[model samples]
Target: MTSLIIGVLLVVGGAMVGIALDRSLLRRWIRNRDPRRHHPAPETRAASSRRRSARHAIEDAERRVESAEAGQLSAETAASRVEASLDALQAGLVLCDRNGRVVAQNTAATQFLQARHGEALVAPVIKDLLEQARSGELVTTRVELHAEPRRSYEVRAGPVERGGEMLGAVALVHDITEHDRIESVRRDFVANVSHELKTPIGALSLLADSLAADSDPEVAAHLAGRMQIEIQRVANTIDDLLTLAMLEDESGRPGARVDVGAVVAAAVDRISETAEQNDVKVVLSNRTAATAIRGSRLHLESAVFNLLDNAVKFSESGGRVDVVVEADQQALTVSVTDEGIGIPATEQSRIFERFYRVDRARSRSTGGTGLGLAIVRHVALNHGGDVSVTSREGFGAKFTVTLPLDSGD
Candidate 1:
């Protein structure tokens, strides 16, 4: 009976121990499968999630850093291009910020700062224009500065705006000195041409009427001669007007080589008859020189001819006129010296002007067109040369022409 009782107790104990072990294993499996049932599993999962999140945050930060670097490079490139574009403009350009303060300027814009009197005239006006632009008013103005050489400038500026917001202002300055000069010359030319033409035309009309009305042979002959003279004067005036206009319109550079010595000789020949009629003697000197220059042959001949003719007509009887040609390494010079009625000092400044004459009565009597010296000036300018006169009243006058030495070979 004791052995039986001991066996039953052993079986019961073994079965109980097996049930407890299985229950413990099942509870562990449930906890591992379901995160809510086990707190330690949830903690492990949370640690892994935090690590992933940290890695993702690091990647996102790297992407943002790269984007910022690219944006900076793009901005720098755009700024460089803007600077280059602004500097290339021919007209002066001034750039201002929204506050109307000058932030950037081009090389040409700096010239306004360097100028003496021009700055005073230009800066204040520009500032005013800019301020006006800030008020949304577009302004354009031309300012004439009476400086040493005299200058004219056109300024155009206005506000730059987008989306109803004023961004800044832009100013453009253009130098118009040459244009103003051309306009002044044109006005003077038209006035002079009309005055000169009307006088000759009126004289011709009166002389013709007198010739027609007179019946006496002697009177008729005198009237006819006078009419002829008046007609010639009219023809000369028209011819001169045409010539001056042609010269004014000529802008092409002379490409042909011209022998200045040859030109002088030709001019002397053309004026020799007139010189002899006036009892004036023309003497040539220094003709055997290498006086060659790049010039228009026709224009040069005309200039020399006019000079010689003027010298002859202004000279008194038995006076000697000298024609000199000289050449050196740097220049070719031609001088016409006349021992005749000379120009007064006060008239020197206006000597080269068109239709200007020191002795109006004498010029008219001699059939002078009053455009000879002006023609000479135009020809000199065309050839990149200059002409000057040295004279004193009642003394001889010397007219000198200088041309840069250019190889005509």
Candidate 2:
């Protein structure tokens, strides 16, 4: 019985040691799972759940960090591309802070600002625009820059806003110099057309009334002759206007290659009567025999005839007019030289303008419509070429019309 009691006590002691060892292992597992928990204690299921939540929170934070880095890289790349695109624009673009200081400018903006206006002029103008924009007022104005070649720019400034708050102002500058020049030309042309048409129409009306009222045959004949001259002048003007309109048409066919020398000869023949009447001798030198240029035969003939007619009209009685057809590798040139009261240097640049005459009285007496040289210039330009003149005030004038040769030339 004593040996049985001792064995039973030993078995109870072994069971108690086993229970302690299990508790120690549970505390060790809790400590290993969550090292932040310093107190050694057996883990409950709630503690294990909290540890799992902490691990998930750490992993989520790492994922967000990676996502944020990617977003930052994308944003930077997008900003870089936006900046590059802005730099490529032909118009000047400038961004300013609310304080009216220049925040950013593209390469075109810098060069255009320097080339367009003086700093003294542009800086103050930009500052005022920025001030206006900062006040939430959209600003627009035209600034005329006085440079070597005068330029006109349209400036527009507006506030840049985000989330209903004004960030800064962006200003765009566009070069409108060509546009303004064209508008001015259009206005002048309208005025000139009105004046030119009125003069001939008025004369015709006066001459017609006089002829109808006159009973004397001699007086009636004189009035009729004057009326005919005025009518012819009006007709010439209309024909020239039509020719110029046709030449400027975009859909007009590329003209066929024609013998330029033959065209010159025909042009001289067409005006031979007028040359004889004016007592001016026309001398034609056709050095280039089969020289050809790309243009309409009728149009080319008209251009050459106009030049020859002008020479004959302006030349002195019995003065000589020379027509020379020459060619080079690239082009065929027809030069008309005449011994006439030549054009002044200051006036030479403007002589090609339509209805422009050096001597209005002489133009009227010679029955000139003042569109001859202008026609020649436009015709040459349309044929992929140009026309130029060299003249001195007292000396004679030489007009050169150069037409581009065909590719096979």
Best-matching candidate per TM-score: 2
Candidate 1, residues 167-268, lDDT tens digits: the string is 999888888888886787678767867877788788888877887887889998888788788788878888877887888898966789888888888889
lDDT of each: 0.83, 0.82
lDDT of 2 by residue, 1-409 (tens): 2221111123474564222334555666777889556653556657888999999999999999999999999999999998899999877788887677788988767864565435335545666787789879899998887864577878788998889988889888788888987787678677767867788899999988887888999999898888888888889888888887877773543557777788999999998999999899999998866587666788889999999999999999899999999987788899999999999987887788877889989987887877888889888887888899999987899999988776424
**In the order shown, what is each candidate's alpha-carbon RMSD?**
8.3, 7.2
TM-score of each: 0.70, 0.76
RMSD (CA, angstroms), candidate 2: 7.2
Least lDDT summed over 10 consecutive residues: which range in candidate 2?
1-10
lDDT of 1: 0.83
| Residue ranges of candidate 1 with Cα displaced over 4 Å | 1-81, 84-90, 113-118, 241-259, 276-281, 292-298, 314-320, 338-365, 377-398, 403-406
Best by lDDT: 1
